[model samples]
Target chain A: MLIIHTALHGEARALINHFSLKRQHDMNAFACFRADNIFLIESGIGKTNTASAIGWACGMLNVSSPVMLNIGMAGHTACSIGECYIANRIEDHATQHRYYPPQLVDTPLGSDCLLTLDRPTENYPEKCMVDMEASAFMQAAIRFTTIELCQSIKVISDNTLKPAGRMKDSEVESLLAPHTEAVTGLASDLGQYRAELMDNTGATFSQLTQQWHFTKYQQQQLARLLQRHQALQPDEELIDTIPAWIDSGKAFMRWLDGHLNNLPVRL
Target chain B: MFSTIYVEEAVCDHPRTRKILQHFRGRTVIECRHYGELLNLKAQNFRLQKKQPALILAEKQGKKILPAPAGYHIGARHNYYFSHMLNCIYDCRYCFLQGMYQSACSVLFVNYEDFIHHIRQQALSHHDEAVHFFSGYDGDSLALEPLSLFAETFINDLRNISNIWLELRTKSTQVRSLLALEPWPQCIVAFSFTPEDISKALEHGVPAIQQRLNAIDKLQQRGWPIGLRLDPLIDIEDFEQQYRGLLQQLFSVINIDNIHSISFGAFRMPENFYNRMTGLYPKERLFAFNMERHDGIVSYGESREQDMRNTMREMLLEYVRPSILFPCVA
Candidate 1:
């Protein structure tokens, strides 16, 4: 699942239309849009709003390998207008806490450092990009997933030549329209990794427990046995080896241990 | 292969760092002032990171040589260990590295000269004692040998220090680099192994037993003395038969009389490490076994441990003399 955080409605406008996402009115704190597997949340403008929205979303959704991406417009001192750069390094000016977003997946963007500020700045710092939500978004998102699965991508809305304060909502939407395909492609690539993690794991233990009579301890043990096999044996179906007439989960585990070697070996 | 590369800013311009960075040029390079910034971070999940770990290159700033554990010595009067690297390429479940480190990312100490300097000092200071410096305690000596150039460089240097012996303990088949060089008699290429069944089940990302044996056989054919290490002997059902089969397999292929030394130990780990490993791999049956805690060490209970050792002692005596076989006892 892709949980995206955008600061402005106009920033999320292109993605909302591109993904055919429907608005969920129940989520009133933040503007939330949902599709089949993608979730985009518009946290108002500051880092606190973004962090709170991410925490709320994460508390609501329990997923195995959720991919988090923070997309917004940032002002750069030297970059050209409408240029997109992935934030490889994020620093919080308020707390001086730094977080690194690992670029493990492919994207159509180069990387630069981003300084997350408490308010907009006319004189951009030494860093290439200046944003308000990336640091907090990354700090909160990483609490849910690894550093490799999180990213902060910014489109250069303002620079030395172009100022962000002069741009309108319509202009922001128009600027983002050109890069909608790139964002979609990035999400698709991330989806492949998320699918790999989910495919390797995500086997529920209820399937075995519902049929077989077992206590709480037996159920937990059986779940670990199955999960270890999944981590070690990714290609084979561990359940297929179970005898059909096993009466208990303890017996199920004993049988599982005996056949640990039976799982087809893959190097 | 590493998905990303984390480099320390202090060693960014070092030649070893540049060499490794050349290979991973297309990948992301995150620079930190210290290696601890990435490796010692809290809330980092080792299990999740193990799916795709990054490589961290840093400089070793402090003492490089350390004393080996009391029972860890093979046949030396003074045993020491130095780690040019912090982690291994293979993911054996029995490895203590998983339980000891918070992250799965491998840390390569790029300063090989510092390690060499300390080793020479330790050997010269204890010239009367027969010191055996062991590599691959923190990481497999040969697994990262190609990238680090540690084994080739150190072996050439240790040729002058006759008082100190070098042990390159590994389970890696990346021995082609070493094969091209002259075989030093004082350096023992120790290869560790478990039974075929246990190895296949628990040893992840390692070569097959036969392939490792082939590497050893090639090394021995060139007149390099080979050592056998069967450590952390796992206790399982029909333990006698399984262990006997493994020893028989070892003696059949290699010349037992020509072997440098053989060592074996029971499966045991520190209490904290055992608890941490169990948390990372709660479903692993290896940790779930009924373990006993004596002082700070956790292992199979006394009676079961003795029984396994008795079987090992009897089987090992059949091929080699008792002096050559070192069973690490607590």
Candidate 2:
């Protein structure tokens, strides 16, 4: 699942139209749109708003292995206008602390350092893109998932030649319009791969617990063993090898250990 | 090829960094104050990142030399290990790096001068003894040789140090750099190997065994001293035939006297590393072997280890002298 957090309505429009998303419940505090497993939320235009939108999405969303992406405009000192770049390094100007979001894909769009500023300004001291919400979004998002699963892409809306204040929504929409297919394709690929990894195990612990009583540690150990078996022998069915009725959880674990012991230790 | 590059701000303008940057111009490059901020972050899926690993160019800080682990040596009393790079290009399923490190990105510490300085100091400190220095401990010494040119550059710096021995342990067939230069007298290019079938199954992305043997033969013909490492011996169904065949194949390639040393050990790993590796590659037959934890370490059963060792030792004795044999108990 891909949950895109955008700052402006135009940023959401390009992707919404590209993915054919529908408006879901106008009564919500934040604007939410959905298409299949992908969702987009417009978070006003500040750090606080970005965090709020992420929290609301997490609480209200349903699914597994959510791959979050934040796309919007950013100001750079040297990069050409309309150039889209992934944010590999994100820094908060006030805190001076930095965050590195993992870049797993190799896309047509290049990447650069991003600086999240408190207020908009023309002085782009360093060769980095200046934004307002990426750092906060990253800070709050990491609490939910890993650094790699959360990615950020920014379009160079303003450079030294073009001031950010002069930028318009239609310009942002047009800039993002051409790349919607590529962006959605990237999200789908990454999300599906991550989801498969999360679901590698054959049987869930909850399902096994219904038939047998197990300690917390036992559950963990059994889960790992089953996961290993599932990964190694994906075509085999775990239930096929089991007795019609498992008398006890401990006995079942013992039987599994003995069964695993007889297999070839090395190739 | 790397999809992204994270360069340390301090070394952003360094010549080595510049060279790498120019070579990887099409890559997405990002600058950071330090490498650890990107390389050492927790919860990174090593298995996933390894699919398209990035390259991190950083300036190594602080101590550049450290004493080698107790059992890691080849006849020298004064032994040390230094890493110019971390992680590796080849993804051998039995590798400990997957568990030892949380991230799979290859970090090349471009400050080779510091490592050279430390090596010179260690040599000067032990002037009477042969201070043996080891490379490729954390990563392959030659796998990235085309870009790194580490051996070519590092050997030049070690020209003045006469009382030290350098060991470049690797499984790569990248001996082109060494073949082009005059072999350093005390330097030994050690190659690690397993049986063809076993290696083909577990050692993914590595060069074929015959290719490595050919490299050893070429280097030996160049009058460079060679070393054979049959370490981390994995158990297979046909052990007697496999070990004997491997030993025969090795001896068929090079003169036994030209071989500097030989070392071997059973597959073993630290407890934490074993747990992590199993988690990463839960389906791997290497980890699924009959292993037990003793004194906070996981290893093949003692009897199984000793059986394999004695069998290989007997076969090895048919070719090499006993003095050059070092069975690593650790």
- Give the candidate number with the greatest lDDT: 2
Q: Candidate 2 lDDT, tens digit per residue, A1-267?
A: 788999999888899988888998963789889987788999989899999999888777755548889899899998888888888889998998798877776566677889999999899867899999999889877767667788888988888998877547787799888777768766876786576457456355566778799899988878866765564455777767777666878887777766666676446
The TM-score of candidate 1's chain A against the true chain A comes to 0.89
Per-candidate DockQ vs. reference: 0.18, 0.47
The residue-level lDDT of candidate 1 at A99 comes to: 75
Off by over 4 Å in 2: A26-29, A59-64, A78-81, A166-172, A202-206
Docking class of 2: acceptable
Clashing pairs in 2: none
| iRMSD, all candidates | 6.3, 2.4
The residue pairs found clashing in candidate 1 are: none
Q: How do the residues B36-68 of candidate 1 rate in per-residue lDDT, one tens digit apiece?
A: 766766655566667677788999988898999
lDDT of 2 at B67: 93
